[model samples]
Target: MRTIDRRPLALAGCLFLAALCLAPQTAHAHLVQTGFGTFYDGVAHLFITPPDLLVAIGLGLLAGLCGAAASRSVVFALPAAWLAGEMAGAFFPSSLALPWLTTVSFGAVGVLVALNANLPRALLVALACGAGLLHGFVNGSTMVAAGTDRLGMIGASVSVFLVITLASGLVVSLRAHWAQVAVRVAGSWIAAIGLLMLGWLVRGQG
Candidate 1:
């Protein structure tokens, strides 16, 4: 009796495994789902998105540099403005995408942080509000395209509140000169990254 050929079976199994490994996976461009709900998804989106996270952190650092009073204002104002912006974007979705706005937002904030600028309370709040509105609007439009609900935006705003509160509080609590300098260093790095992103954007457009 002829022995069964085991080599052919092994080859088939290897090819099947390779095919499985090379299979394409589904990707979500805008929303990130945690299986909990849209709310958590929104929170996850804020942390995962580089531009949004960078701007949020930069704003927190700037507010902390300003003073405790300014931080307080930012902690509330930013989230509120973000929610409002999201609402507007959801209601009036625009086809135009402004990726450059995000780069500029974080770049400007990062520069301010590096400078350790002595910004007035009003100016700080204004900056926070402006960043919130712009970023939130972009997020809103993306979420709409992704079929995510408003709850996600609210969740994102909530995350922003917590992030700002913690980040600003940490900076305000630091008494060491070196610690402050370190924060500024981080700001400079953020600015450098933003510049790099801007260059890439220009290259892509070109």
Candidate 2:
């Protein structure tokens, strides 16, 4: 039996993740892109939006750092809360606070990941639920404005859950010390980006 060396593969993946986290982001950019006004559009929109993509990555990293129990909690809480928020947003869609809320959630979760928070499972679930609500509301509001229907919203919610679950699973599967460290490094990069985004928002407002 031959054992394959997997360290290089892990290192490569970590580097790719770090690069993604460090990519430049426009502070005033719209977080949602118009899709085909169909269910698939919802899925495509989630992947195409940079802010949404990063938020999912941040949530996944945070959950992964907290371990399997926390990960499971996130998998459930995120989608459920998002669906609830989506339903709410479909009815009440105007939001001036979306940008600020997004930056805060991004920064807070990044900090937790960087610190490798070992929070109680309940706290992790609560955080995931809260983040999901904010994320889902923003997504939902955007979709509604784009004239998408409930089916589209459902597609978006499903995509959100799948993305977060996959990212968290990827990080949690890392068993090597260096791989774990890479996840933390990615978190730090995310936090720095969030801070920069906040500063940009402030400057624009002033």
lDDT, candidate 1, 1-206, per-residue tens: 99998999999998885554333322235688799999999999898888889988998998898889999999999999998888887898765446667787899899999999979999888888898998888788778878889999999999999888898999999899999999899899889988988787767640
| True lDDT of residue 186, candidate 1 | 83
| lDDT for 6 (candidate 2) | 100
Task: Write out the backbone clash pairs for model 1.
Answer: none
CA RMSD per model (angstroms): 17.0, 14.7
lDDT of 2 by residue, 52-96 (tens): 677788888888888877898898788889888878877897543
TM-scores for all predictions: 0.84, 0.80
* Root-mean-square deviation of Cα positions for candidate 1 versus the true structure, in angstroms: 17.0
The lDDT of each candidate is: 0.84, 0.77
Name the 10 consecutive residues with the lowest summed lDDT in model 2: 22-31
